[model samples]
Target chain A: MVAQSTGADAKNPIQVIERMMKLLDVLSYYHDPVSLKQLALETGLHPSTAHRILAAMGATGFVERGEPGSYQLGIRLLELGNLVKSRINIRDSALPLMQRLHQEIGESVNLGVRQGDEIVYVERTSSGRSSVRVVHLVGARAPLHVTAVGKLFLLEDGLPALREYAKRTGLPGLTPNSLTSLPALSRELDKVRRHGVAFDNEEIEQGLRCIAAPIRDDSGDLVAGLSVSAPAERHSANWAPLVKQTADDISAAIGYVKPDQPAARR
Target chain B: MVAQSTGADAKNPIQVIERMMKLLDVLSYYHDPVSLKQLALETGLHPSTAHRILAAMGATGFVERGEPGSYQLGIRLLELGNLVKSRINIRDSALPLMQRLHQEIGESVNLGVRQGDEIVYVERTSSGRSSVRVVHLVGARAPLHVTAVGKLFLLEDGLPALREYAKRTGLPGLTPNSLTSLPALSRELDKVRRHGVAFDNEEIEQGLRCIAAPIRDDSGDLVAGLSVSAPAERHSANWAPLVKQTADDISAAIGYVKPDQPAARR
Candidate 1:
């Protein structure tokens, strides 16, 4: 489903649902419990409106009141989420491939798919090194302009959709190296499409460098992207071929046939 | 927030929301993709009504349409679920302790909390052995009358609530050892309350056994339960005390301070 806010059309029932969805969005952003006042400020809703919305959500177990006045997403949402994740066959299918990539690169491996204006991580595997900490959780989202997986999906969607997406979500810089203009990003996507790979040169995070490739379904539609991320010092130009080959292997395993290859080759 | 349905009684907007919640209840039962016809049959609604409800849910990104008109909970739900799981401090607080128990006992450890009539697993750690394929994922639910963790939560909520829960959800036999009558289950809960531990001797699954303890908050009210499950062949009489001690240790680690300590210790 598309994640967009309904406009201020009073005749739309979806508008009411949009307001409710906004409340959830505000709650989801906080790492700790949030108070009603803070929620009102964040959502630009009046205190009473936010309070009533939160109460309705809490009653249905969509949001929970924790530690007296603070609120967080409730357990019911988690149950629903678990059901969703289980139904997505990609998670189980890609896990072994992700593990192998992690072993080969000695870095964090991620699998992500485009959802609306952002890329959502579907699975991640990290090398067992005490010094490294993986920042991307299974359900975390990143902007399309700033991440390797995002660029991979953008390139796979082709030029027209990529131009539209860049127009809509404007390529804001997350780091100094991140492409902040649509023209620059368009040129980058063209390069990615030619090479069948994308790179994040300390764009999403200051010290992190990532190389990614697109994963396609049996229909040749871009279904997801796979990447290996490590500190920039460790990820030299030599790692690009390895990451692209691993991604192709994963794509083949998931029933994606190359353009001229026979089905029997799989 | 509670997980139980309040049923259909269209009194006001809240009741209308309750009707909508019934649709969610039907979706929550199956992890696999379900058809609109199946949802209509399960919820006792007309096909047209089910179609509209599913469409609304799908549009809102709460449910996703899978292959050939089948429906499943969407990734948006998982994003929300990850938010809820992150705020659940008890899961992180109990993980190291659960890991220790799993290592000591060579069993699968589970951490769960009561969500209305069911226990939803918040965290799980497997033995990671090739021989065992215990496939309980995080966020899976179990009935309150069957599993050891479920029984622990029931007992922690006190005997009166336990009786009411059993009366409402009827203790049907899941396996030969499941307690099928109110009186028998009430007696079992009483013993668990007195001794601070609960056991599942093939009550949920025929060849599995589990031991669980309640985790209490600062107010001494039970917030969750921790348990370990193993094959019934591993449950000799000699292992009872070891299981009980492990449960007690986890309970203590999660802030279940004993009341009857000596004055010097206090």
Candidate 2:
């Protein structure tokens, strides 16, 4: 299935595909168009090899010639990316990331979304090794002042709206640690705003604590929350960074971009 | 079997890249996992050839084996697509599509976004052969009731909000044909709701008309408008479908999916 070393790759081996991926990886590293020489050096492919492959990809729009001899990643990747983003379910997208986090921490990871005033558990992954189980089963619900994810949605509502929410919901509590007063809820939400994450502090159950981070969509609007639930003794602040990262990864899977990008926000 | 490339592409093209593209195209065509037999049949590739390539792509996550030997498009495309979508600007994304629409219709194409109560023209392409040039400059602004793009924003506001908008603006008129009354604005918005398109009918200037369709983001929220502006004599209902399609295309570039898919609406 091999042709002359320069001709049709319709039958080329996995090695060619790996070389193509390396070239793509290098192209993505440069913010501007990259020179053929630099691309070849970065990928460790011969200049002629890089040139021929780049030209082939150019034909298929995997790369585009920019500013003469330099090249940039093409719009074709974005087009394909959009198709993938649109076809995937958020729950399905979040599960693997959640599983990775769970396997790392040996704790339960939960994905929740705001439904009315309550945060509804949409998906979760857990390591069976935990001695104390947390009740983050699928379809469970908790009020805004109690769960870490609920507190995030409250903060997103802003202060005045948060005050109104407190008035409406009467700052309900599931346990002694819950923020049952408007002042307590207000202070906790302010911390949520400052830290860009929220904590349940054993509010949803007697001995279980949770740490949650916001998950946003393309327009930078918070659409869901990613959190880790564990026994209060086992839960640590160290979980915050990983939970936040996994949440961000899920958001990116759904087409989110930070405002600093040229894509900007809606 | 491989892609039906012409003789022009037969010489010195990367065969693996061509085969990879063909496999991706075939994978994207089906909503579910495609068997080795079906993929081979679809791409005219041998089953062994298809399996090996799919295996390679799976290693890179561009394809995933689903339910044994059957294959489906992988999340790697989504990951790369997110990278592209997040980095691209709306104006940058819209211009190429706008130029294509202009070339097809031989008229001016415009991209506009709502600012306060007005739609400010953000980008445009014109054939230069127009008998009269339209003032769709980069920063041109028009009231929500007087321009095709503007009416779309008004329609998105719904009836109660539209009523408030009419009250707030007093239904200002720039031309005799403008929708100056609440009843008129309401009726026009109703048509916009029904047809999912809007019109100006020379309301902004004498003999100049425009047709606009809504542009939404990945969340299905209206973010901008895409339209065709030309002399009233040349404007027709036929432009509606193209304008709508182009807007939808731009939406797709930014990670939009129609409601029929499993991704569902937020």
Query: What is candidate 1's CA lDDT for residue A12?
Result: 36
lDDT of 2 by residue, B3-73 (tens): 56533454576887777777777776676788989988877777888888888777666777858789877
lDDT of 2 at B86: 56
lDDT of 2 by residue, A27-136 (tens): 76665689999988877788898998898888776777856679877766655555665576789878888998888888988999999999899997856777767777
Colliding pairs, model 1:
none
Tell me each candidate's TM-score: 0.39, 0.73
By summed lDDT, the worst window of 10 consecutive residues in model 1 chain B runs over B257-266
Q: Please state the Cα-based DockQ of model 1 relative to the true two-chain complex.
A: 0.16
Give chain A TM for each model in order. 0.64, 0.69
In order, the Cα lDDT scores of the candidates are 0.72, 0.79
Among these predictions, the greatest lDDT belongs to: 2
Angstrom error of the Cα, residue B32, model 2: value is 2.8
